[model samples]
Target: MQKNDKIKFYSCLAPLSFLYGIGVWLRNRLFDWGILHSEQYPIPVICIGNLSVGGTGKTPHTEYIIRLLKDKYRIAVLSRGYKRKTSGFILADSESSSWEIGDEPFQMKNKFPDILVAVDTNRRRGIQNLLSLPEKDKPEVILLDDAYQHRYVTPSLSIVLSDCHRLFYNDKLMPTGYLRESISNINRTDIVVVTKCEEDMKPIDFRIIEENMKLRAHQLLFFTSIVYGKVKPVFPSKACFLNHKNIGKEDDILLISGIAAPAPFIREAEKYSNKVVPMVFPDHHMFSKSDFKKLEAVFEKMTSSGKLILVTEKDAARLKNNPLVPESWKNFLYYLPIVIQFCNGQSFDETIKKHIITFSKNNILQNKYE
Candidate 1:
């Protein structure tokens, strides 16, 4: 939605926002006062989350941390597995699909088969289950995806991500804006990362944001931007992987996504193809035969023979599993993968490594095992 459109739409619902804010405030206060206990464990627990309802780039940031420490530590990733059909704790295995363990967890499992991936609505139980694995098989470090608000298990390190384009500072409470909690709650975070930033973001812009946030001395800040990778087939056939430059300027790209933010994907696709047609859906939308038919109609309308369908990796997880999706369409469909690139990577990397290292030295689990 455009800024002015969001402002108008939210303004109409401003009254409900007051009640929503109160509920969030009370919950936070309970946690703050110890009325609601937050459990702490001996081993290091790192959490990556956001204050907004969606579109903060938490998944990529969590993946970045995993990539950083996976070699040195026996890492496990735990999530609530939003929108999954099953309940209770479930571990990702050969049988797991996007439907069984949710798209993100399934994607993570596919990407990092060596690491432990499990999901439970009750994060504390999930942690306990992970710890219960045989002594040698137990994870030394746990990466909690999107669990900052859970508060039941207190993470050793908390990193809160805020989108550079749609910052928490500029947002309001739920019904009024994207923020799930007040911006002030960011004070609880150990690190604040500004994500989806431009590659050439000005230092003055950083200074302006820092001043606006009024961050505490204990809190560290960093900036990162998205780096798109080559577009590859969703299902292997005769289709060859193609980079943006290799794709013909005359090719008409059909961009399909069911994500909170499709603007970035759309913007990136336009750079690769002269004629880009977008087919957007609500976040985490389940595809039906009707949807596929609509997509086919759009594909048929394209005049250029050099045509392709593009999707995000997360979307690919859902689409690849749908039974209604035709095999013919799957051959034409490709998904773009993305990674987070820190603006000042050296400092970010050093700080994260130092914190984890320091925790390892001081943690009781490390002492016992070592």
Candidate 2:
């Protein structure tokens, strides 16, 4: 069920939320007081995370950072590999699968093969394992995916993302709302990125949000909108080669997704065709033979001549690897890739570059002093 559907239960469980908030607060306090130490690495460690449980556009934003610094630095991304079957530091290689390193890390490895991608639930040990590599193999910069509350390793730059539709300030603690911690915790973050803003958002809207956030002088705020690329076949086959944009207006689309936020993706697909049918699933839901049979039944029912199955890029990652899915369905399956476009792109880019360069200088100075 969707998060909004659970609102009635929130009030009934409001008291539990109070206890959850206290636990989160106490843990952060210990870290702040040095009772819990945060390990630091010499080179830059950039973290992309959110205050909420999910659906703040962390994957695409992490991809944005990879695109930015991949050319300049030897970059590595370390994630907890949420829901993966394995444990410990398992590096992505030729034999890695979504089940081994999680879907997101596997997706990143496919996109940027030259870069390093590893998964370990223990952030400190993960970093150490990456650092233990040969000098030439070690990454000069590390990017931590979904590691905001992970105070075990202090990131040199903490970029906390907030969904524009569901702002953390407007939400409550878990079981009551989506926020993982208090909104006041944002003060600890160095950068605040408001993701999924409308393309036509006005200058006054930006100012109003900025004022509402009451950000600190040191916290740099940036706004970004999602840009959906042309839809391509999930599994390339000779029989099916048409892109979503190539389809006629009269076409029917069968949208299948297992993502935290499908509203944005569904809206985009509707723009291409009016008849968009959704086959929704829970986030990170693994597809089974029964699910495929149901999807097949749905596809067979669509009487329209121009019809195809479409999914978000993340969903495509899992579906393509599922052996239960018939080969015939693969020919009809397609996915749309997404990227973040900053509203104030120049300022955002400059800030990231400056932080990285400053860290480089500090590393040199520290080495000389030692």
Candidate 3:
């Protein structure tokens, strides 16, 4: 499918929303009645999710929180393993490949070895398994990636990240628009962060977003940006070089991205490279033999001679698993690790800390993540 198909736009299916609402209500009823079950992990669970469609910066934000809490707490990250070939709670290992766990979780495992990364389509089962891990490996808290819709496991702190560009409050439910749930669901979030802001974003932007959003009584609002700094080339054997500053410092970045949106990647790439050539793909696109040959041929033509190839951290996760990547090309293929740091710095972390503290004090973060 093309990129536009993935975008949540207003649909003519609004008449079926009554049916949609019924499905929503019945699903909740099942869990509420214990007919369908919910599992509470034996540790604190913090979830970063969006009520709408993609581009809320959930992954980077999740990585940020995980890194922040790792020093003081043993943490584990659980994701649905969204489009993997496998289906089960597969724990991440240095030896574990993305084929079994999918790219995102595998990427998480590679990025944070100290933390346990688990993937399963059934989120309820995933959390249960994590909680069941040995005491030493048992995390103080579990970070559920993209789990706001997984109603089975109730997180202690539910952080809802929204885009300043698109607020759910102004949108309609799925198929009708981007919203996964009704805008009223904002009430469920403990905090709302307007992600992907400009470095010099004015107060007017924040005011515009906040003014448009229908905030709940308990939800706190904040803004954040992508602090792009350096880009490192990925090689099969761990062989590479940088130009005093870094790789991708030169012009002409050919960006190969299989993500929700290529906009952010393009924007970041332009900063380091003179121009960006985006080879966009459907989210979680599986590379085919024909596709590989086609892309390699394209990359070969782009480079022409000297080393210059760049891929996002997500795409690199998949590439790392496949042995097909030539050792020589590995050194040329660059990947940049991005963290969602606030425009200022400590304020966002501090805000999260306060919410975590509150959860602890209220005993809400206890052994019941369900």
Q: Whole-model lDDT for model 2 versus the true structure?
A: 0.90
Candidates' C-alpha lDDT: 0.88, 0.90, 0.76
Per-model C-alpha RMSD: 2.4, 2.0, 4.1
Between candidates 1 and 3, the one scoring higher on lDDT is: 1
Scored by lDDT, the top model is 2
Candidate achieving the largest TM-score: 2
Pitting candidate 2 against candidate 3, the one with the higher TM-score is: 2
Once fitted onto the true fold, the runs of candidate 3 whose alpha carbons sit more than 4 angstroms away are 1-13, 16-18, 25-42, 236-239, 243-252, 303-307, 326-328, 357-370
On residues 1-370, what C-alpha lDDT tens digit does candidate 3 reach at each position? 5556544332347767656766876786687689876666435788889987776778888888888889998888999887788877888888888888888888888888989899987888888788787888887788999999888887877889887667677776666667777776678788888888877778887787877776866677888887764666566457565551553444445678887767877887776666567888887777666767777787666643434667778888887777777665666677876777676458778877776666676676344654
Q: Give the count of colliding residue pairs in each prediction.
A: 0, 0, 3
Candidate 1 residue 207 Cα shift, in angstroms, is 0.9
Error of 3 at 65 (Å): 0.7
Off by over 4 Å in 1: 1-9, 365-370
TM-score of each: 0.95, 0.96, 0.86
